[model samples]
Target: MFTKILIANRGEIACRVARTARRLGIKTVAVYSTADAKAEHVKACDEAYWIGEAPAAESYLHGDKILAIAKLSGAQAIHPGYGFLSENAGFAESCKAAGVVFIGPPTQAIIAMGLKSESKRLMTEAKVPLVPGYHGADQAIDLLREQSQTIGYPQLIKASAGGGGKGMRVVKSFDEFDAALASAKREAISSFGNDAVLIERYLQKPRHVELQVFADTLGNVVHVFERDCSVQRRHQKVIEEAPAPQMTPELRHAMGQAAINAAKAIGYVGAGTVEFLLDQSGEFFFMEMNTRLQVEHPVTEMISGQDLVEWQLRVANGEPLPLTQEQLKINGHAFEARVYAETPERDFLPSTGRVSTLIAPETNDFVRIDTGIRQGDEVSMFYDPMIAKLIVWGQDRTQALQRLQEALSKYYIGGLNTNLEFLGNLARSADFAAGDVHTGFIEQHMAELFPEPSTPPDEVFAAALWCELDHTQARASKAQRQTLDPCSPWAIADAWRMNQASIDPFEFQVGEALYSIQGMQRNGTYYLKLATGEKPLSGERIQGDEWQIVLGQKTLRIKIIQSGNTWLVFWNNKVWHLNLHDPVHEADDQGVHGGGLTAPMAGTVLDVMVKVGDQVKAGDALMVMVAMKMEHTIAAPKEGIVQEIYFQVGDQVKDGDTLLSLE
Candidate 1:
């Protein structure tokens, strides 16, 4: 085993690997960028070294700097955790050339499986069943168009060099093929630095099942069962569960063997995932194999009772497989929900902000949270928006799913948008509970899954107290915790007496609506005066972020996170953003989206389609902005003439900054 290893990655995976290395008595060296100087992963390891600037190209993707850092840290091996340089065959070769062990598959295996087109050709010779599509390197637009017709409609155009939905597109008909092709290529280049694409039959309702296969340098390979990642959005997985809900023993054997065969064909070593598209009729076709640990590997770990990271270290150290395929057994069902810092309402567009408050359900035998995010950490536009992965296990699927829902309820995030409520709704949904899941699970049941965007009064009431209460006086050290009265009228149980009592109305903005709430002490009782009407209410902070809200006779625990002027209220499993409404700032920003076209989030303008005094119709593409690997098209909201253009192509714009003007 390596006495010390350098983790050539960042975020949760780096922290995750560090944890396993620590448990195994192996010291870890963390490589970080400028943005991650104070990151959680930096503190998770014994030592941390700065590589370069924040952009991945400047830091994480620079293999030379990473190797130098490894040498400086005296790391015997380098673990490229999942992303970044994990699948880079050149990096693996470089590590070998530097006389440093790469804790991944051999360079030859990586070269064979790195590109989708080449990997599919190799899999074909291995007799692995594949979906019929165009896997050739002919990048001619006309040729690709002709190939799409040959493959038939409902085809998928995927980036050959990468995955993660960045360079993938679904074409429903001929008319949609060209635009999708161009868009997919653009995203592919932006994400993977490769515009090479391959066409495949898009299995519209197929279940995304993948097997966890481990191979040792000594040529021993074993399958660790399967995981169902059918629940997805925008071609990316959302929720994953192990021991697919309706998988039969016969089918499991077939897929497991197929996955093993695929790995063996590439002389694959260490941990790799073999993915497949399982049709409704039980027929499965091979998708591309991931040459690194998957984001959803926790589900496999939970059911199989194996530490995959440790397995990776052992295999990289030339140890044989820990157990035979026959010895490996599934213990229980497990589900993993990838909680992200994104807005489900806004088409799941990645949201960037400071994570002011983050609290997960207490981990026990049944629940696990793998995360590197800390309170006050900035969720920037430099990388993936995933906040954490929540995993739960139980003897059966039902118990595990129940635990998942319960755990989601306790998971809370503040000061930014998150999919916490969306994941909870998914866990509690009837269709998901009944095991009727597929790639279109989210879109198929959108209405029931997504509640109205408007914040309800209960949450607004929570925000009222969030801004009204002062938390500094409430927080007590452990030594003084016992002395503080839990039921004090000023702290927990009844309405707090205002230090400076007055009838001033508190102005709050919930979503787009503004409310003026007045606190009135009438007839020795308290009543809240709102724009809608008046209500008798009282509240106090019961614990950290949790407040006891009293509405007439009923009492409820509402989670509130206050950061500066922004307040994130978590009530009834949903989070509502509340800010003290400033009419002055509102008037200033009216032209942001009203008169002048504005950037939705911080990004560079990729295209500018219009100029001053140009005529455009409603819904016409005006500009394109790409940020955090996500592309957004700014369209004309109404038929108008372009009055002014504020930004040009390749110019950076902040959130809500005006881009162009229309009249």
Candidate 2:
């Protein structure tokens, strides 16, 4: 085995690779950009080096700079984690020329499967089952239109060199083919530097099942079963599982053999995945192959008891296969849910901010958390916005899924929007529990998945008041700290109420709704009154940042953290932000209002779709902003004429900065 290897990636994948390398007694080196100077991955490595600035093009994607760092650090190999430069054939070839081992498939294999069109041609020659579509090299628009008509309606236009849902579009009719093709091509060129595309038949309810296959220098290839990645949004997998639910032995065997054949046909080595689309009729067709370690490989590891990274290391060191195909067997069922820092209510837009608080579930033999963040870590706008991957294992699929739900509830994050609540809802949904999943699962259950916000229970509001009272008492005790008194009146709940009962009315706001509650002390007992009814309430601070509250027949544990003027209350696995209303210090509205377009988040303006003096209607795209690798368009709120344009393309703007004004 190599003594040291350089990880050519950052975030959780970098930390994940370091962990395995350390287990095998191999030293690990990490490279980071300016944005990740103090990142967890940097601290996880034995030695770290700064490559370039925050942009990936100037840092992570600069193959030459990474190669120079490898030489300087005396790293014998380079592990390209999963993203960035993982699947770059040129980078792999450069590593080989520099005499440093690349812990992935050979360059020839990567090139063979790099482009979808080329891969389809090769797979057809290998006798692999393929979907009916056009894989030709003609780039003419009229030719593509002809092909689309021949393939019938509801076809897919996919980027030849794309992954992660980028550069993909689905056309439902001939009338939409031209526009869809143009949009897909533009995205493909921007994302992958390639404008080539291929058309494929769009299946109504196809399940994405992929087989994990590995090969060695001696031409020994074996399969590690499969993972079902059918639950997706925007063509990206959100939830994944191993030993697909209700999979038959015969189908598994056939798919496994086909995957092996596909790898062998490309002369593949190291870890790779062969993806397929399983139709409703029990038939499957080849989709494409990923030439490196996958993001969701943990679920496969949990089920097969294999460390794929270690396998890649061994194979890169010219070692033979660890075990033959016959020796590998599935031990149990596993599930992996990707937790991202995004807003599900706003169409899953990526969110960026500092993580003020983070609480992860306790890990054991059955539950695992693969993450590279902690409290105070900033989710920047330079890379992917994924928070972590929650993996769980059990003796059966039901048990594994149940454990998944339990773990999600225990995970919590604050200071920014996240998909935790949405993930928990999906995990507990009846349809998901029953395993009725496909690529369209989220679309099919959109209503249940993104349900309207629920009103806070009365106990929750009472708990908030109890928290406020505790704070008041603590402050009073601190003020009286100079004089020590065993029977200080401040220590008593009703001490401030001298001879008569005191009723204090407070108003709070949650979102757009305002709630009013009155706290009263009657005969030394506390009660809260609302329009609904009156309830006796009591609370005690349990420890740091936690409190136990009792209201009527309900007992709850809540965490209350104050930020600025708002209090963040976490109860029953949900977070609520309550703002105290104080009329004394209220200020007049001075921010942007009426016909002004402001940025929703900090990002670089990618394009200005409208110019000054241009007329636009509601929902017309005015500009496009790119942040965290996702594009969000700013649209006109109502019909108006653009009077002024503030920022041009490539300008960096802060959150709430007015981009333009309409009259």
Candidate 3:
């Protein structure tokens, strides 16, 4: 085994690699950008090296800087985690040239699978089942259109070198073909520096099941079962599991053999994923092969009792295969839910801010949390917004789902909006629990998952009333203590008949809806009764200034503060700027609907597709902004003429900053 290896990545994957390296008695080195100078991954390594600035191109993507750091740190090998330079064939070749082992597949294998068009051709020769599509070298517009018609409508246009939903489009008709191809190519050029695309049949009800294949230097390749990554949004996986639910032994046997054949066809070594799109009719087609460790590899590790990273290290050291295909067996069902910092209700947009408070659930025999951050860690716009991955193992899928749901509820992130509720709902969905899932699961149930807020108006009222009562009594109790007697009449009591006038009436909005709340001091605690419900509420006092109240089975924890006439109740992960003004003092501050297009979050403008005075439709792309490595298109809000363009190509924009005007 190598004595030391440098992890050429950052965030949770870096930390994950260091953990596995420590188990193998190998010292680990970590490389970080300036933004991750004090990051958890840096702290977890034996030594840390500063690479470059915060942006990925200046830091994580700089292969030379990383190679220099590895050489200087006396690292014998380099482990490129999933993102950044992991699949860059040039980087792998450079490592070989420098006499430093790259703990992954050979450069030739990477290049073979890196380009989709070339890989499809290779798969065809290998006899691996492939979807019918166009991978020819002709880039002529009319020629591509002809191929699309040949392939059939409702086809997929994907970047030949794309991953993560970038440079991908699904066209349902021939009329939308030309525009989709252009847009996909533009995105492809920006994301992967390749405008070449391929057309393939788009299955309506498909499950993404990928086989985890590992091979040693001696040409011994074996399949480590499979993971069902069918739960996806925008073609990106959200939930994954190993030992796919309801998967038959015969199906597994055939798929495993096909995966081994695919890996061996490219002379693959180390850890790689052979992704297959399984149709509802029990037929599967080869999608593509990922030439590195995958993000959801943990679930496979838990079920197979294998450390894939250690396998990568051993394979890189030119070790022979330790196990054959017959040796591996699935132990149990495992699930991995990717916990992200985004709002599910607002179209799942990425959220950025400081994570003021992070309360992860207590771990047990069945639960594991792979995290790269802690409380006070800033979740900036500089990287991926994945907070952590919550993995759970059980004897079966039901038990695994139960453990996962419990863990999610206990997780508390204070500063930013997250999809905890969405995950929780998915865990309990009947269709999901029964394993009747597909790529369109979220799209089909979006309305049910993000229904209009069912939180009652009265619950908001009760929360406000309870908050005010707690504030009033605490203040009066303090004043009474300063008086001469220890047990004065004003001393805090649990149940004392209190005057209604002594307490305050509260009102707040939980969105666009309003509620009325009033509370009275009863005993030493505050009792609030909302107008919508007959049940009264009692607050659970915590610390000196905060109170937690349970209303309608959901807990509302708030920090109380007074700001002039309004009482700010920090609830629903936001500051509720309640209007406490009298009827005469209140002024309407209704929101206006018109404005120039605003950047949803901080990101770089990849393209300004339109300019000043350009005619636009309601959903026409004004520009594409790439933030946190995700592309978001700013579109026109209404059919109008473009009045102004405030940004240009390659401009870094902040959230809420206007990019253009449509009038």
lDDT (CA) per prediction: 0.86, 0.89, 0.82
lDDT of 2: 0.89
Q: Point out where model 3 deviates above 4 Å.
A: 456-504, 522-527, 532-594
User: Candidate 1: what lDDT?
Assistant: 0.86
Cα lDDT tens digits for candidate 3, 126-224: 999998889987889999999999999789999998787778999999999998999899888877789999999999889999999999888899999
The true-structure Cα RMSD of candidate 1 reads: 5.3
Tell me how far the alpha carbon of residue 131 in candidate 1 is from the true structure, in angstroms, after superposition.
1.2
Q: Each prediction's TM-score against the native?
A: 0.88, 0.94, 0.89
Residue-level error in angstroms, candidate 1, position 123? 1.5
Model 1 agreement with the true structure over 155-188: per-residue lDDT tens digits: 9999998987878899999999988998899888
The best candidate by lDDT is 2
Displacement of residue 311 (Cα, Å) in model 3 is 1.9
- lDDT measured at residue 74 in model 3 versus the true structure, 0 to 100: 97
lDDT of 2 by residue, 562-660 (tens): 666676677665667777887788667545587788887778898888888999999888998877767677888899999999999999988779999
